[model samples]
Target: MIEQTLLKCEEMIQRGSSSFYKAFAGLPSPRREAVHVIYAFCRMIDDSVDEPEESPYSIFELRSHFQNLDHAEGHFIWPALRWLFENFPQSSKDQFMLQMQGQVRDLSFTHYETMDQLESYCYLVAGTVGEMLLPVLRDDSNEEAQSAGIALGMGMQIVNIIRDVGEDLTRGRRYLPLEVMEKHGYTQQELERNVVNDRFIAVLQELKGAALDWFKEGLDNVHTYPPESGMAVELAAAFYAGILDDVAASGYDVFRRRAYVSDEAKLLMFRRTAARYPSPFGGKGAAAVH
Candidate 1:
């Protein structure tokens, strides 16, 4: 029964986010299964708000069940959560609950006016993910390591905002800060019109630069992770960062097309990563130390 429950979680992750699944698949045993569970719950929480009609549980229901997980019933996720908590007692329930709180923001926030607002939203939605994964992926969840993890999540969230601008507009949501847009001379009207002009490019570049900066801060503590895990984190960051490159290659048409790194490119990236981390771990540098 436990095996079946974990398998359901695995399927949820494999179906929902292949990139995430691929990056962490190398983990051994319960750790790998744990990642699957975390992703599945987070995905469900996100879908509950983002696609309420289709989600299995309302956001409120999810929180209730998660808060009372030991006796919670009625879904593979509940059993999976029970197993996760049983196996990893150190896991932070607070981080998981905070994630639910973050999803609730989508219910009311339709537009953002300041970088502070955007950052707070990003932290709630994505930074918490890093904190959630820290204990599962690394030996130490110290303040510095956890902070770096949040930075990585924030960077990835910025990339998501840049890539999903068009899709977001369809939902009447604009994550880009009004101040940044104004500074770049790109008006909200221009964004709504899908005008891919110089100012638009500037706005994207500004966000892209910010994303890269956070990525650097995020990776600053990579060596603190287990070798294979460090490699996986690095790879996920590389793939996300690649989206910006593809956007540039597409002449910045984020409005009409979603940019992606090809499977072939992923293979090449995997090879480079494998070379760095090696089979028995320990390569060098900030990624695979000693």
Candidate 2:
């Protein structure tokens, strides 16, 4: 029954996130199902917020729908949470995702006054997703894996923020914190115009540097998971990293357009995954075992 539901989730994600479906293709089946389920839920929530033609309903109304689904508590996450809770033990970290997703649904495009606030928001929305997936992928509940998972999510979120500069502006959203902009001498006005000045480039570089550190941290931390679990993390990390490559290749022109890895590049990433699949922790093989 769970397998069927998981397949349903995968189908949902396939329709929602073509980029992710392609990247996750290299993941071993065991780890792939859970990641797909989680992503399906997230993609739905994100669409509710980011979709251009979404209903004119207020953020509160949208949040209320999920809240009602969960009986006014954690309904937004019920689609995924109910499955994990009824079928699998609820990891403490997984619980955080339910609450965090609700939080995101409640708030639309929070304007950050400082770097710290932006970091915290990113951790809540994206980092927590990584943390939640760690237990499912690693097949264990441990501090090291949880911490690393959180960092990995944070890194991915940073990359996403950098890539969405132009898109977010069009949507009346800005992920770049105000203090960082001021420190670099860019006003909110500059952001709206999507200016591509040297100061803007410097600010972006600074954010990119921070994201790189989180990616490094995530890579190191996932090493503790069994080799099979590590394979899942590796696949996701590799896909997100490709975004960075696209950003750099575009000369950080996120102000003019969004960045994306080409179909050819995505196929290459899939090939790399097919060529190597070690144990999540350590082992030699073409695929990781749970």
Candidate 3:
């Protein structure tokens, strides 16, 4: 039963995030299945907050279900998550709680006033995923690897915020720090009006610069993981950072259209990473990674 559930989880990831699915494919057996379970659980929680009809009640239910794991026997996500927590107790518990905290924060429809506040939100929402995945990606529980993972997740989340500025406005949320916007002479009113002017572009450039620095920090420690895992992390980081590149190529007009990295670009990135490393994991097609 758990096996079937995990298979469905894999399908969910493949459909929702091809980049992550591709990265996970590089992992060996049971570990890959484990990661799928993690992704599925996170995806479920994220949807609870982001989807139009979903409500805070779903998050409350999740909290209740997590607290009473044994009573959650029949639940699809709980069983898998229970297995994950049991297997990776240290990494799973706190990180999962932090993720839930971030989701709860999303329900209030607030704007971040400062960069620190935004970073805190990012750490809870995305950095925690990195910490949770660290145990699965490597045997050693070192601080450097965990830090790098968090940085990687932060970089990706920042890029997501940059790309989704217009979409987020429609949802009555703004992830960008207002302090930074004010510093760049960009106003909330202008943003709401979908103004893509010099000031807005400047704000984006500053945000992108910070994101790129985080990516560099993450990539620097990518080699800390075992070869295959390191490659996977590297590929994932590159693919996400590629979106920022696409945004730049589009002249940072995030309000005009959403930025995305194509599948062909992803495949090319995988091949490039494989070629650069020259490992047994290299030269295989996307399907081969699975």
Candidate 4:
């Protein structure tokens, strides 16, 4: 029954995000299942806002049930959460709540004003994910690793913003800070027009610089994580950072062409990760994991 229950989450992860599912799938059973559950629940939370038709519960209901998890029922997630906490009690309950809290912000905060505001939003939505995964990825945690985890999460969220600028606009949202645009001499009107010129590129470049800094900070102590987990983290970061290069290759026309890393590129990333760390499962190192 438990195996059947968690398989639902495995399916969810497979369907939701290839980079995530592929990166964590290699963890030995307990850790792999734990990552799947965490991602599936997070994906469900995001879907509740962006694709509510598909999610089982609304954000408010999710928050309510999550607050009362032991008695929570009516979904695969509750049982999955039970298994997760039962096995890995070190996972942060507060971080999970903050994740839901961030989604709640998506309801009213459709647009961003400044880099500061955007960073706060990123922390709510993505940084918390770092905190949530830290315990599961590593047995012992400290301030340094915790901070790096948050930095990585927030950095990845910034990449999402850079990649989804066009899609978000279609949905009446803009995450790029107005200050960023103004500083680069780009304007809201230009963004809405899908301009991909020097100033426009400059704006995203600014964000990219910051994102890279966060990625560096996040991975500063890569040696600290268990070897396989470290490799997985690097692979995840590579897949994400690779998208920026794809976006640039397309001349930064994020408005129409959605950037993606190809299978060949993903294989190369896996090889690079494997060379840096030893692992038992051994990466597929072939056929696009992303």
Q: What's the TM-score of every candidate structure?
A: 0.94, 0.80, 0.94, 0.96
Per-residue CA lDDT of model 1 for 1-290, tens digit only, reads 99999998999988987667777777767888999999999999999998999998999999998888888998999988878878887788998888899889888988999989999999998999988888888766689999998999999899999999999999889998999899989998898899999999998899999999999999997887888778879888988888889999998889999988776676667667778776555322223211
lDDT values of the candidates? 0.86, 0.68, 0.83, 0.87
Q: Highest lDDT, which number?
A: 4
lDDT of 3 by residue, 44-72 (tens): 78887888375333877777777787778
- Candidate numbers, best TM-score first, in rank order: 4, 1, 3, 2
Candidates arranged by lDDT, highest first: 4, 1, 3, 2
Off by over 4 Å in 1: 280-290
**Candidate 1 Cα deviation (angstroms), residue 223:** 1.3
Better of 3 and 4 by lDDT: 4
Candidate 3: minimum summed lDDT over ten consecutive residues — where? Answer: 281-290
Residue range 193-239, candidate 4, lDDT tens digits: 89899999999999998889999999998799977678778888888
Q: How far in Å is the alpha carbon of 169 misplaced in model 4?
A: 0.7
When 2 and 3 are scored with TM-score, the better candidate is: 3
Candidate with top TM-score is: 4
Cα error of candidate 4 at position 91, Å: 1.3
What is the TM-score (0 to 1) of candidate 1? 0.94
Separately for all candidates shown, the number of backbone clashes (residues 3 or more apart, or on different chains) is 0, 9, 0, 0
